[model samples]
Target: MPTEFQKRAGVFVGLVTCLLLPMWRSELYCYTVLCCFILGGTLEYWTAVYSRVSSLQDWAVYLILFMVWVLPTMAALHIYGGVIGHTRLVECLIIQLVVGDSAQLIVGRSIGRHHVCVKLSPKKTLEGYVGGFVLTFMYGALVHGWSPLNISVVYVFGCIGDLYFSGIKRRLGIKDYSRILSSHGGLLDRIDSFMFAANALVWKAFFFSPE
Candidate 1:
């Protein structure tokens, strides 16, 4: 019986090896990873919605699902494949997100005192958020040359994305979208914030990037 941390670490190492080994030689591999996220996320989302047995119409549910999961994923593909024509920038963003998320967890547990949203996410705190933001900014600025605006977009929308999914889970009366990943819930649970931030970056790059 593996512990939760072991499961997480094992999966993470495998994923990193797969992504980094062939990432530079072939862009298709990266797209495949994104597609997996969207597909898994969509399934988990649909399962949650259907299980809730809401009074909303089927069309309404589908529309919400498309907007929340599918649309953002498509937008991300466009940004990375068509618009930017490279995965380097997005890779940096992913690294920053990982760093920031870890920071938030560590700082929140260590010294966090004020909850950011008690109703939506009880464990999230203002101190944690600030710590994550500061560290993310430093890493992105120093290592990736990410502009302040880009860092801001990722941090802000990442928070929004996490809360948005948390809201869904709260409404659905479930702790996770699925239990596929052992202690980590599901693929969607891990990449929800990344998906949202990626799509937000898509729009920013589309309208703002001179390239």
Candidate 2:
């Protein structure tokens, strides 16, 4: 029997392969992967919202919020990959987000003492936040020569993205979003930070020289 960590690692590798392989091989595959993620995330969002709310009036508000929040964030990937033809750029962003998130988890579990937000995300810690921030900033600088603002957008908004989903889960009284990804929960849970970082930084990349 595999332990929880093993299950998580397996799923993580598979997910990364699916995402990066498509980027290297074909644009169609990339879009296909994105569509799958958007559809899965949308369904999960709908499930959580629908289960909690009863009134159509309340549903209307959530529906609108969904359109506004989810679509634009996810579409940022398309802007980079499809519109900009910057697949490597997307790849770098994905790697940084993944590494930063992994750093947060590892450092948080090992030496984290002070909680960042006990109510929104009890497991998050200040030490973990700093660890992720410093490491991601350095890595981004070395790899992409990204500006401080760009690095901040990726790290800070990544944290915000995590907390955003966490707040939703707390409100809806559930965990993991869905059991689709074994120990890692749903696709949305895994890519929440990426979605937010891309959405926040993609436009900046368009307007200014990040290199």
Candidate 3:
């Protein structure tokens, strides 16, 4: 059932795990991995959205888009004064993303009646929004073990972030940023949820948290 892209991506992800897990996981290591993932994902996004872009211009668009995702990462890594331990920050970002995506699946399967964009992504719906919110909030509960925040703040912002990126994809007239992920699509498709959730986490940790 898996497409060629899925098989390839699965392998690549496995490779990444092997390559990175042995390094002892420093902030610098996290930063580098985050940087590469964002850059690859951004390239996928601009390529998918800007339909009129030529292959030559893809580089330019990618470079421009890279900034959109990168500055936030840098800020979170360096300037984020939040008391979030590295493990907590990582856990929150990854978990919220997974929750948001699971929400999409639930909404699509159940109440996704109205088309999100009609043409761009027909299955996306307000129902999915609810799913994403609930899931994201629930996942945020995991962070309470290590950090601060009530459920409302965590899921609300996290869901908004996922929807924000989803909206961007819809407007760009593409799906999943790229088909590079096969069933998963490009790096952007997989990571958009992460970007939104990470940004939300950064905001909470640096600006609002009493800790």
| TM-score of every candidate | 0.86, 0.85, 0.66
Candidate 1: how many backbone clashes?
Answer: 0
Give me the candidate number with maximum lDDT: 1
Better of 1 and 2 by lDDT: 1
Q: Write the per-residue lDDT of candidate 2 for residues 144-185, one digit (tens) a residue.
A: 676777788777877888888787778668887788976678
Q: After superposition, how far is residue 150 of candidate 1 from its true place, in Å?
A: 1.1
Q: Which portions of model 3 miss their true places by more than 4 Å? A: 2-26, 46-70, 80-83, 111-121, 142-151
Candidates ranked by TM-score, best first? Answer: 1, 2, 3
Considering summed lDDT, which 10 consecutive residues are worst modelled in model 1?
A: 88-97
lDDT for each residue of candidate 3 in 118-149, tens digit (9 for 90 to 100)? 44445667777677666656666664453335
Model 2 clash count equals: 0
Give candidate 2's TM-score: 0.85
Which lDDT values do the candidates have, in the order given? 0.74, 0.73, 0.59
Provide the RMSD of all predictions against the true structure, rounded to 1 decimal.
2.6, 2.5, 5.3
Q: Which pairs clash (backbone N, Cα, C closer than 3 Å) in model 1?
A: none
